[model samples]
Target chain A: MDEARSAVRAARRSDLHALTDLRLHFLGEAAHADARLRLMPDARDRTEHALPVWMGQADRVLLVGLDPAHDPQGPGADNAAPVAYAMGLLGAVPPVLAAQHVGEILEVHVDPAHRGKGLGDALVAILGEALIGRGAQVLRAAVPSTHEFARARLERAGFAPLQLELERSLDAG
Target chain B: MAATFASWLQDPARLVVVAEEGGRMVVGFAAGVVLQGNGWQIPARLGRITDAYVARPRRRLGIARRLAGRLLDLLYEKGVGTVRLAAAVQNEGALAFWQSMGWSDLETVLERAVPVEGRDPEA
Candidate 1:
């Protein structure tokens, strides 16, 4: 058995292929789900348009945890190679929101096989370090209302849920 | 719908500030949104107002009214059809402020919270 020593780092241009592979691994099969959510336009168009610009945005952070010992270096190591990852934008200091810089964790996922192995915790630590380096004092991980695993992770990481966004469609009436 | 309309009202193209007295202070500020889009498929252009905050001490001096009038002019210039805005459900003072300025509530947002795994379901 190989030693498991992984490194978590900021997304680089060289990581594009790897990141895309990871995205496709987790998200590729859900193509039809976009249409149902009316996110088809964003999925089909804006994702490609926004990735690099989003990468450049100051409040955005995309990170991956890589285990070189057990993982292959190329396309093969895309999602499978990454035991865990945390990707999302840093919150803008919007005048409306009093918080200065909130850490917005858009997506944090670990391979089911690798769960409980500290990969998720390591990824969070890396993301938290990256966020703190960028001047974020308060971190808010936006786990879905139904994600028990995510809630547990955040709570274990010392985060308490804060704000709630409630939305309704007027057209429904 | 109110949120959408509120965002529209804050559209930069519809909002403007007029500084009075050689630009020392803001005499009037108007906020609104455009409701018209391509072709006749959409209804008439709308220029909805969220707020027109004029200095309180400057009220009835036509500053507030003039600001509102100018905001309407901007909407007309943009070919807007219908305009709307809302006051908060509990903000009676703000409601009265808007009502006094001819605004009404067009929608309400209801919220319910559920708990799961010791986490706020709404968060």
Candidate 2:
């Protein structure tokens, strides 16, 4: 608990178990089905299956933050012990286009107890730097209006609203 | 340089389409996915058109329409009762195109920022 450094670094496959837990903690109850289908399966099975693949993908970058104050082990921190995390795609097409290489924020989540900390901001800056270094020209994020905290975080990180999608009732159609 | 888009599609969740002209040129393409339920109780599938492309010479030949229709049919077959897609705020022509195909607006997603760093202003 000597130095409190919110370092943003590449996430390792070993960290998937904890990341999945964090995702479930934040998104499990309220997230739509697609997210659940994508993230919340048998946790161990999915983590084991997806994490290694993710780590191998050059386009994907998983940034994690550790507060030495909380995780005293420094960089050797465990999967169940992340202070915060940000998962992003380096070359992505916004929802409006078919192209590629647009930086995209896939997921950014911090433990509820760590909400007020600047960990989210640090993670974003790290991700941005990594992305720009890898040739990302434009970065985009898709956040629901209901996610006030995430929306605020993205704006603070310098992202602006570029597109708005609407969904009509199937009954109406 | 390697085609980044093709390499990016390795994610199992993505829906992708591509057309190659007998190994000499690119022709047409489209892509989308059915979003069923991430957590909500909504049982219907929501189709999202992520990418649609057709070479200029292949335009006006019903390629895009067929591609879109094929995606829609795939969604229906997959048990998605409804589908949604988005367009840029200024993409009137694209908007018209979706409308022509029976897709419509959904909801507006907004953004706000949390201040970080620098000197705190006087209250």
- TM-scores of the candidates, chain A only: 0.70, 0.75
For candidate 1, write residues B28-84 as lDDT tens digits. Answer: 677766655322112334456656676777776767667766776676667653455
Q: Candidate 1 on A31-102: residue-level lDDT in tens? A: 223221122323424344455676788777877766634544556565544545578655655445363555
RMSD of each candidate relative to the true structure: 11.7, 9.6
Number of backbone-clashing residue pairs for each candidate, in the order shown: 9, 18
Question: Largest lDDT belongs to which candidate?
Answer: 2
Model 2 docking grade: incorrect
Clashing pairs in 1: A59-A90, B9-B32, B44-B81, B45-B80, B45-B81, B45-B82, B46-B80, B46-B81, B46-B82
Across A36-126, the per-residue lDDT of candidate 2 in tens digits comes to 2233345445545665677788878887776535554545555346767777776544434555456667667777777666777777767
Error of 2 at A40 (Å): 6.3
Error of 1 at B12 (Å): 6.1
lDDT of 2 by residue, B1-123 (tens): 136466547754456666667887768877777665543223435667777778888887777888877766665566666666777757776677777877654433433232332212321
| Per-residue error (Å), model 2, residue A35 | 10
